[model samples]
Target: MRSSNYDKFPFVPVAAQADACQVGWAAIAGVLQAALAAQPAASGQPVVLAVECYPGTGLRQLRQALTQALQPARCLVAGDLYRPTADIDAMVAGPLTDDPVFGRLNGLTISDFFDAEKLRAAQAELAAAAGELVLVLGTGATLVCPDATVVVYADLARWEIQLRQRRGEIANLGSDNMAEKASLKYKRAFFVDWRAADRLKKQVLPRADYLLDTNDPTAPKLISGADLRAGLAAAVRRPFRVVPFFDPGVWGGQWMREKFDLPDGPANYAWGFDCVPEENSLLLGFGEARVEIPSINLVFAHPRELLGEAVHGRFGTEFPIRFDFLDTVGGGNLSLQVHPLTEYAFDKFGLAYTQDESYYMLDAEPGASVYLGLKEDVDFPAMVADLQLAQADSTAPFPAAKYVNEFPARKHDHFLIPAGTIHCSGANAMVLEISATPYIFTFKLWDWDRLGLDGRPRPIHLAHGAANIQPGRTTAWVEQQLVNQIQPVASGEGWREERTGLHEREFIETRRHWFTGLVPHHTNGGVQVLNLVQGAEAIVESPSGDFEPYVVHYAETFIVPAGVGAYTIRPHGPALGTECATMKAYVRT
Candidate 1:
């Protein structure tokens, strides 16, 4: 019920003391009434007043506030008009208009209003002396009386203060806005197959010597020797998956692979390197972890320095492309499995297929054959059905599928198993391990009932394999000079040679170094992924990148990032097959 000072001398106007008001309505009702009170009761000329007030929240207050102001006994003149000019002069003072807010002066929260028109009419009908008058009350509305008095009420100041305070949080003297980061990087690796591990270890693997720690007998085995041992879960009963970035000590939150439905097996399967208090780590697996006996580290990781910021959203740190490891173990005497092409991959996954893969011969018994392509006069449909029957039941007695090209695979031999090429590391006994980042969009054409560890029948992709199969070519093209050019590189004893290839994104160069004294050295650019073919009890260097050599056996995959470019390899004497030590290296291009 605050009020504006009343300045009057005539009619001894019982000073129109008013009730409490919101900052706005009080000014409107008070000023209008005061102007009418000052009017000459006998004069027909009504005093006009343009009234205004500061508007806050007082819609409900305005109705009751004005009603009493126009009481029959309390009013000499009433104040019930928004602009005083017009129909207001003819209406009852109770309320000049039915439209809520009384000409928009009050709001929807109205409780009551008095008729100033009623009083004005009463005065006129009773022949009471009173002039035609004008009254106005509004938010931010101003008024001018015949007496030359001007009244104004407005509130543009308070709101500005509230708005400014909210905008000052980003990089201000008081607080930080916490902008979100959009880009990320991490260290990663992938590999499979005993031979690939063999070819990888003696050669490029020595560079990642930082990952080996053979003396720790407790470490798990990659390619279980003649005596198979199980860990964590019973042999093959539980799902086994990739080991996340291994932390020699901590229990939970170690490897990235555990992030998905993948199962955890023995830590020694495929050991990866990671530091303590990890900034960020992610392990992803597509299906039940596919085993890569004698492994290769598929580096799907980023250097730690880059994973510095906190990841906020789910699926926030997604890889631009799929990261999958394909294994072609025990060449099934036929080239059968196949994957979709780039055009197909893009249509399905919204990106170009990046699974450029390569295979390393782990062990090729005499007369070992590799079907790199389909031979001339081969029929796609005939092959598809035969493959389906054989895969559904290894004893289906399918005929020998014609080979477009075959290569004599010896130990440590390597070949580019790029997309679209219908290739298979042939049987007699050879482990063709694969390395590629693209997820498998496979249509399994044949599985030979391969008898997964679970004893369940393996699935086949008859349609997809037949779709991508390229038939009608030479029977021995892999031995051609052009094809031989793409092989793995070797530099060690016992390992006859190194084969190599200029693979697309999924692969780079493969190093086939027959073991000697593999001293760890810095590999330029990205992580150096390693797979051990044979050997055990090897000495792995400490963080300083310096250590004494130790012994190690075959069939192990090691992942090492650019950071720990330090380590030394000391192979067990010849008695432990020193000449047999060998490995290959894969890096991001």
Candidate 2:
């Protein structure tokens, strides 16, 4: 019902002037041409330009643009050096397994994709092109010409890659399956393509001459690699936000579409990825131009500073905490599901940890409810049989209400869901999902007999869900352990803090603050993610003026890196004198 103040493209201002970034093909090409001209061919050999791209980056468009501008004597697509698509399909079949939604993590690198003979031949071809400009480009261009005169690393965000996959505009690396189902393509990218591509990107980004932002194929942006690094370094020193993306789902709702002022296209918006670094983008501002890069790059490049010593030591370069929105307002119920326990996750999926989560109800309708745990004294075997029968027959919907405990949900109610607990949020509720960031391991047991947007039955992993479901998590246990486990922790003159769980078994801890005045906060040597759950606007300020005051709007999530040390928040703008609330999550340690 409120006007949308949600910022769609949040960027960290990196430079005082705009000259560091070049926008559009003409501007970007001009910068590259100047760099090429400055560094002439050595020993009368060709000036080799290497455009190493992240998979799903539009290489064809990049080649055409740069070719027209630079007039390269020869341009080699890295795919030509790759083994046949059939061979790659066979090579990845084991890791990609036949699963529609899950796969083993691939250990392959970009080098493994190339044919040894073809690579050597390409090397020779580049060497023989004396006195002529040669361009080698694709996902493994740097590997093809390691000693190139200039290197451009084209980077695209994971969400953008997924959109491209959904549109059938791109395919996984070293494969010719552009027409594959988006979900299957996403599985391949998650388990195979991205893993291999990330290995190469880590090596190339730190030393590449330029960083290309290719999220928008029509208008690419270019910045020096040094500027990109500087932007990342600047980010960790302050409270910043990753660019959030919204996606529709089978049980999506209209809350976000109306509240976020999203265009009317998708039927509804289900997810708002507010702080998922692995799947979000971060924009770096250079005066007039903004360059988009995968938010994970910041986590990779500055884990110690951004995550703090303790968190970095535990998670390495990974950002373990995630904050996202799940809106089912004016929609249908979420699928009944369970996440794997830690041991099972590692044994089966190579995950070091599991997805232990908590759902904080941000808004709810009069009868909003959440399905959690199980019904007391329910027939366990009969429930499983019912689930199996439902899976087997489309017309028979699993009787969820008969076996699951439905708890009334209200605004600010936090429900703890440790791994192995059966749970789902009922429709007409907006949820702020805070969790450990192994997000894709969900095992759905039922989907209300609904078909997906692609007009096919959604995949159900009854065996996986049943194996992980804890039968002992019944009504009484859930009442005592999960529902609204809130305890008053501390208070100030105009503010009070309460510990809103995450069960003891979970690594993440959450807290809620109700304030009408300044509320002091510290990272305590670990990264903290927070959202202004109940306010029109609030200003986050550094106690020592280390960083500028950052303004966050209602339902907007932001991160305070451990490096930020101390900060304070207070209602600002329209919420200046009104009581406001914030929910914060961090690693338990």
Candidate 3:
């Protein structure tokens, strides 16, 4: 499950509300009628309906639908009860927390931005009215109206919000420079909304009479008499894909844009949240209607079903693995960073797992290099001092290259980066990062004195990084330990498999294969994540007719559930080759 701190949108087609008002309203109508009847109108009390929602959830349409669906009931916008925008701005500008990683946690939440007392007063006044009352609010509405006859929580996935932000549907919430900034510039607003969602899930969602998945502008999925856990469990049973989200950065690259045919965003597209469920959104399809859900909900709902028995027993609902992309093609280098040890992350950040990542070089420019470990003979204290001086002044005491080691990067090269190792992907490289589920624990030590794309100095955690640095991880150690130990494992007439990442310390293991015909794959009671890394396209099928065969395109990520134990992969394309390379990762035995 996602940690508490990791509290980590739409269009106008036919309003599903039209049909809903005529047909689906009967179910909701019956529930509301009962609740109202239970509390006699003779007591001079009105039915209070609370609608709490994430931003960009299209409250206007829902309000209109509810007005018609519940005759004689008044749907009112309760924005008047919220705290002033000036107050919110002041709260955001206040001092930050000591730990910069999880920044200031208090003032950035919805609780700090909304006035509960004012909302309660409004609720009281509305409850005293002659007819039923519906309160449409963005924050703090649920907490304030505990006596509401009916509560509805409107939500959208994170990727959907990013898409809405890109389409100018959502307003920028950070600094003025955010106009030129990537979607990440809205970090403050994202976290605030995240905390709000977390609160709703933990506090109000179970009691909420209805949950609206407002991802589709035309058709939203409204679950009446909601049960979040049961809904999430059902969602995991089906093979679903989280919408891939992309962002621009100071070191953003063009490989993703060219390969995925992505739209132009901020200069170039750098990172792709292909399968980072912690920050990605799940797409639930029901015929023509689509609902967006936070991907982590599945982990919390079905730990054993999704992660297998042993893995679930070990990690306890943690996804345990993540897949993402890092593009440096025609861009700058990533910051030199190190992730904390497992104990450090758990103790300091409250994370369940630490990030132990590997870079599978999908593509690399000639002479491209990766910075790994440290130089052979360098002073540890001197290197630390140099980093500190560089962070304070604009210049380093000594050249960075003098202290860091760089190795030539090539296509299909895999470099293991366990915790406590310093590493960075240099420019002109497109990397596929397959790693542990903890993706946000990166502690940057150096950024080449460059500012972020948002015009702010990127944070450097020198002290935290220095404390965890393995100084003995010099060039020789990297050559011996970081380099992949590739060995041919199995072979057949027209197929062969090579184990590329079975490092003793890593939980997730990888295997690559080149085959011309079909290659059968078994899940071994553990979930498997694979990508058609080199092939143009491939068809994944179940030999026993267990599930539908899905076609995955080049660079696309897909999952074979633990229940779907056995499957097969066959390449299909006009451009034929003797073999195609496919990479697979799963929990080790």
Candidate 4:
């Protein structure tokens, strides 16, 4: 592989004073203490501070630190105001459906978890504390003391939360199922907790006095709310990248470990989350301090500017496109799976769109191939029966070759896979997966007779797969419609552009540009996601000098917000004299 230049901790530099952010517990405590002291005494009433936290933050440790430093007269945990655990379980039972991997989205808010009487009593108790320092902290602390003298929002990234869940370090909101299966916990959080938390976050973050980065328990970072907002605003006006995370899986490979210089710990790495805003973190640089927050915060804070008006109107504060990596090189194949159709997704999971995806082969071994569609003249019922038998008995391996067609894969090959299409990348291939944002709706039909990393059989959804599978998508239809449908669209001096197939059924349009000179690009009133697929390095700059020059390396994905109207890219550094290529994806207007 070319010398790896992948940046793991990509941060956007924000214009802020040298001391705008504070690092470590000592500095953060000093800042908070100073802010509290500055507040004028209120008619002999106690100074109240509200530390509102996102679910999954280390609340116990946070409270311990603050309590020791501030010596509050009264410290109220907002979780105490929640209704009984049994009542909360029953209340969320409908949204947290029986399915292990899927649940229906609900409209439950954070307030729904609290008992009205308990909330009122807590509010009254905080008001009664006179001539003392009072601190209210927890997931719903803001609800208890909305008019506090100081509000600190302790936030955690969703990816960190997932890691904590896997380590059994935290539990879902208002629930005591810390020892439950991580998958089940994730399902509950996705359908119930996060939806509720995000709603409150949108309301609280805007008015919060300070923003706290709680991703790291030992070392915390604190910044003023205005500085955080300014960082987010700066991000949307330029091309930037969210911090990418890598994870190992049962069928993982060593491509990321070797190429990205990942530390040797896990057996192998399988998934690289490059640009998933909902699950990734965005690092904002303030002088020397680097603060990490959920990348979705940018989407929520500036939807119209990041995503164009047309996209914002359709997706509504949701990022509709996703770009990630699937590495099977030197490992086993991915689970044979199919995504739910659009209507099936909406009716069952309340998702607005399906995961219509394409696998662009970044690197492939000589004999690499992809399992796609079905073999010609295969019996539909017989295929389902085989999948069911294989899932029921782990010892028996499904005859995938008899039912699924395998196509030869090579570097730069684009394979389009709309929803309801049976597809998976074969072993020894590295794939750049471009798709719509509904990422978790996949229904695994079969796994290659292997237990998961947890030593348990992975869940299979044969019934869901059978219901959504398009029986008519045989080998011939797939060959014509899905395989490497590249067409020349435009050409300029030392540069050429080609339209790559995302299929007519998909909403994302992808274009490949091979250039040896500067190539101009426009967002066309929609957000653009691009990856440098062919070269070691390239620079993205504004044509009208609107934003600073942004550099990207091979296999690195970066986003240009819709507000960035015009930009240009050219080979830079090691790729200065090479014919570099980039693949760009955007919402088809």
Model 3, residue 401: C-alpha shift (Å)? 2.2
* Superior candidate under TM-score, 1 versus 3: 3
What's every prediction's RMSD, in angstroms? Answer: 31.3, 1.3, 6.9, 1.4
Write down the lDDT that model 4 would get: 0.93
* Runs of candidate 2 exceeding 4 Å displacement: none
Backbone clashes in model 3: 1
What local distance difference test score does each model get?
0.35, 0.92, 0.69, 0.93
Better of 1 and 3 by lDDT: 3
For candidate 4, which ten residues in a row score worst on lDDT? Answer: 40-49
Candidate 4 residue 306 C-alpha distance from true site, Å = 0.4
Supply the TM-score for candidate 4.
0.98
> 1-589, model 2: which lDDT tens digit per residue?
4569989888899997898998899999899889989999988588999999999988888889989998999999998999999989999999878878888775899898999999999999998998789988999999999999999999999998998998999988888898988888999999988899988888888898999999998788899989999999999999999999998999999888888898888999999999999999999999978989999999888888899999999998889999999999999999999999999998888889999999999899889999999989988899999999999987888989899999999999999999999999999999999999987999999999899888888899999899999999999999999999999999998899999898999999999999999999999999999999999999999989999999999999999999898899999999988999999999978
Number of backbone collisions per candidate: 89, 0, 1, 0
